[model samples]
Target: MIRVLIADDQELIRQSLSFVLDAQADITMVGTASNGREAIELVRKEKPDVVLMDIRMPEVDGVECTRLIKAAHPQIKVIILTTFDDDEYVFGALRYGASGYLLKGVSVSELANAVREVVRGGSIIMPGVASKALEMFARMARGSMQIAVDTQQTASLQENEWRVIREVGCGKSNKEIAAALCLSEGTVRNYLSSVLSKLDLRDRTQLAIWAVQTGVTADPYGDRT
Candidate 1:
């Protein structure tokens, strides 16, 4: 079973999410917290497989909590589920190793699916948030953000791997990448894992940032420099 912890300041949200998610046979609600400090404490004790975090919690906030949780327990996955779609919160949470960033507006089913996806080593970003993220990355790319990549390592990437990276950089999910490349979702997952290892990236969010910074997403089919 996929164990989950909910960290939100609102008691209603915490209870409601717990009630719905616990009903899933594949999921179990391990605990709930009203603030970042409590979230951190619960995480240390419960050690859930996934954490559903809110960004605006008092004490530590979601971004810091994610960082602390990942630092102490790298195997645990944290997904930011907040009402805020602000760029700072989105980028900060992802940069600190959040596996996913989802708005609270998502259906319970979608949220549940996100938890499962992250547990499977996948990243999730809400569609609207994804577009904004890509745009922000593009803007940063145009400015002073420079990501140095190893030429030899990059040269070792296979053509199919390059295709997968490009799609990921474009903010496409495994399902979307599979459809775009006419490959199975499992194949896409493999490619993603390969790319992550090859590039020494922690997760898809970093890959997307690197892809944009390196101009990989600028020309999908163009020559690799």
Candidate 2:
């Protein structure tokens, strides 16, 4: 079963999510928290596989909590489920290793699917949010953001790893990258993990950002105006 924890300042949202998630036979509701601090504490205690987090909270916002959770327990998956999809929060969540970013308006099915995706080491983002994030990524890649790794490390990537990074830069999913590269989904995932470690990055989001910045995909999207 996929163990999940719900963290939101609103009690109704917490309870409602708990109800919806508990109904899923393949998922179990492990715990709930009212704020980021509580969320971190509950994560330590329950050790849930997935956490549904709200961006805004009383003590320790979701982004900071995500950073802390990933730092302390890299095994845990965090999916941001906030009413707002502000750019700063989106970037912060990704930079800090959030597994996914989702709006609170999502249907129960979408929510459940997102949680499952994160547990599978895949990520999901609302299309609108993703597009905006991509636009931001494009700007950052244009030289506004400084890549943390050394130039030599980037030159050491294998050809396959380069392909995977390019696909990631183009916002392709693991399954899509697998199909495009004519490789198995598991292989794509392994390549992604290897790329992250080799680049000394935290997650695919960072890798995607770096790939674009480093010109891995001169035109990440082909034949687009």
Report each candidate's C-alpha RMSD, comma-separated, in the order given: 1.8, 3.6
lDDT of 2 by residue, 91-175 (tens): 7777778876888778889888888877877877766576666775686666556567786776667778888888887777787
Which candidate number maximizes TM-score?
1
Clashes of each: 0, 0
Kindly list the per-residue Cα lDDT of model 1 for residues 1-225, writing each as its tens digit: 999999999999999999999999999999999999999999999999999999989999988999999999989999988665556786678777888788886888898899999999998877777787687567656665545568777977888888888888888889998999999999999988998898887788778878888777877562364
> What TM-score would each prediction reach against the true structure?
0.93, 0.84
- Candidate 2, residue 145: lDDT: 62
**lDDT for each of the candidates?**
0.85, 0.82
TM-score of 2: 0.84
- Candidate with maximal lDDT: 1
Model 1 / residue 161 / CA error / Å = 0.7
